[model samples]
Target: MKIVIIGSGNVSYHLAKAFQQNNIPVSQIFGRNESDLKFISDQLQIPFSTSKLNDADLYLICVSDGSVGEVSRLITKENCLVAHTSGSLPKEILAGNYRKASFYPLQTFSKSKNLDYKEIPFFVESEGEEDLELLKNIALKISKKVMVSTYEKRKYIHLTAVFACNFVNHLYARAKEISDSQEIPFDYFLPLIKETTQKIEILEPKLAQTGPAIRNDERVLKAHEELITDQEQLKIYKIMNESIKKMYEL
Candidate 1:
């Protein structure tokens, strides 16, 4: 199956490489950004890239939510099987009376690091049986953990992912900033963070949760307040602590 990726952002870059690494064919990559188009083209050794979306067996739209619909309308072929990599965007956006589907990989991407797609959950959907099977086959070739998700189920999963991954990563970023301001090495927290994440694999996060929030220790809370100067950070800490306490009935 000859695959093509639209957009050379983090999602597109990672997915394209995964496709290539798994021995799945990647024919071309499209990106509006000249640098992005060139980057993926050079890296994948499939230099037949364009700013416009040419024809392909599968068009994996990895553009931003703001641009996906407009871009899809402009680029897709009448008979091409189009799919978007977005989790939050509705499948109907890609459904234009064509063989449309979704190939959403639930993982973050960065240029420096290669992703292990085998471990990431792939939420795929299609309108027709043939198209569904094709998408499923393609997904299963790259990953062993492929799941068929309806539009509603995908929406729910995407929502939970935002809370679990994106929101939590944002918290980690804020923690790093706070640590930097205090002249503390952010790497010092990495081992504890890794353990926290790993513990949840064996136990529920609620069961694994620790610290003053779970303990409802007022003294520790007071100490934390002195460390953060930003009112918003302080508010977030207080709200999260309160929510944690309320969740476990601490």
Candidate 2:
């Protein structure tokens, strides 16, 4: 089936690359940014246009959440399947006469980072069984895990991703800030971070939990709190500690 990818951001680039690697032919890529679209088109050897929207069997909208509705309206292709790659947004957000669907890949995409697409989970939502199966088949080509999720379920999935991926990355940044202030190399924490993630794979996170917070060591917590000069950092540290304490009923 002919496919067209929309947008020029990381998601668009990665999705295009994944499709190319899997021998899926993308008829064209449509986007407003010429330079960015050119980069993806040149790399993937696919035709692209800043002004022209290609007619295809499938159109995957990879634009930002706020732009999904506006971008979907741009597609004049009626009775064709139009899907958006957004985790939080529903299929109804795409305002058009075409068949609206969600083809969300549940992972962080970075143009510079190479990922095993087979390991990523794709969550698809559609209004009909036929379209849902079509999306599921396409997703299964590149990923081992694909699920049919409702909008309500997808909402919680996105929220859980924020806690697991986004918030965890932010904490790593905060950790680096503390290490930098003390003239300690941030690399020193890599092994610990790796082990922490590895441990969670085998053990429940609660059972694998460590640190003064879980132990409810007020002495150590107070000492660390005093060392943090930044009020924002201190606030986060205290809130985390209190959260841990409450979770474990310490």
Candidate 3:
């Protein structure tokens, strides 16, 4: 099926590449930024446009959440199926005279980082059964895991992802800062990070909990708080300490 991808950000870039890698026909890409669009177009060897859009069987809008509705309004094709890769936005946001769906991939995307699409879970919703099945078929082509999720459920998933992925990454940045301040390589924590993630694969997070907070070692927690000179890091440490303490009823 011929597909037209809109936007030039990380999600759009990765989706375009994944589709082309799987030999899916990507008719054209549309974006306001010519340079970014040209870069992707050249990489995929597909024609791109700043103002014009080509007719295709599917249109995947990968623009920012705030712009999904606005971008959907620009697609004039009434017969083609349109979908957006937004985790929180409802399928109704693409309400128009055409078939619409939500084709959200439940994973963080970065243009510079290559991802295995088969490992990414996709959450899909559609206006009709036929369109939903069509979306599932497409999703199955790229992802091994696909779920039919409601907008409400997807919003919760997005919220939890902010905690699990985004917030956790910020903590890693803070860890790197602390390591760098001591002239230590940040890679020292790589194995710790990997082990922490792996533990949750087979165990509940609470069951896998360890460290001073879980052990209720107030002296150690206090020492850690004092060691963290960064005010923000100190605050975060105290807050997490309290949270972990409460979680384990320490």
Candidate 4:
């Protein structure tokens, strides 16, 4: 099916590349910035436009959450199906004369990092059965895992993802900061982090709990609190320690 991708940010960059790799027909890529559009156009060898947006079988809007409604209003195509890659936005936000849907990819996108689309889970929603099937078929072309999800369910998934991915990544950054303060290489925690994640892959996180908080080792916890002099880090440590204690009823 012919497609036109909107925006030139990380999601747009990766999605367009995946479509190109799969030999999908991309009529054009559109954006407000001519230079950004030109760069992506040259990188993917696909024609791009800053003013003129072509009509296609499907249009994927990969812009920011705040701009999705504004961009959707700009698409003047009458019959073409339009979808956004937002995890939290409902399909109703694309309300207009044309068909609307959501084509959310449940993974973080970075332009520099190559992603295996085949392994990424895609959550799709459509207004009609035909359009839904079309979205599913298109998702299947790039990903082995595709699921039909409603806006309500998708929002919760997005919320949990914030905890699992974004918050956890911040914690990793905090750990690196602690290590850096002591002149210790962050790599020292690599094995521990790897094993912690690997354990959760086969066991529930609650079942795999360990450390001073879970073990109710007050001496160790106190020692750690003393070692962490940074107020922000100390606050986070105490909060997490209390959370762990509550979780395990230690």
Tens digits of lDDT, candidate 1, 37-150: 788878888755554555677788999988888877765467778899888877778745567788888887888897678888888888888988888888887888888988
lDDT of 3 by residue, 1-250 (tens): 7889999988998888888888787989999999999999988898999998888889999999999998999888788899999988988899567888899998898877999999999999988999899888888888899999999999999999999999999999998999999999998889999999999999999899989998899899988878889999898998998999888777
Q: Compared to the true structure, candidate 2 yields what TM-score?
A: 0.98
Model 3: weakest 10-residue lDDT segment is: 91-100
Best by lDDT: 2
lDDT for residue 83 in candidate 2, whole number 0-100: 96
- Residue-level lDDT of model 2, residues 1-250, one tens digit each, is 8899999999999999988998888999999999999999999999999998978889999999999999999988797999999989989999989888999999999888999999999999998999999999999989999999999999999999999999999999998999999999999999999999999999999999899998778899999988999888898998999999999998
Give the runs in model 2 whose Cα sits over 4 Å from its true position: none
Model 3 gets an lDDT of: 0.90
> Which segments of candidate 3 are over 4 A away from where they belong?
none
TM-score of 4: 0.96
| Clash counts for the predictions, in order | 0, 0, 0, 0
Better of 1 and 3 by lDDT: 3
Q: Write the per-residue lDDT of candidate 4 for residues 74-124, one digit (tens) a residue.
A: 888788899999999998888567899999999998878999999999999
Q: Over the full model, what C-alpha lDDT does candidate 1 score relative to the true structure?
A: 0.83
Which candidate gets the maximum TM-score versus the true structure? 2
TM-score of each: 0.94, 0.98, 0.96, 0.96
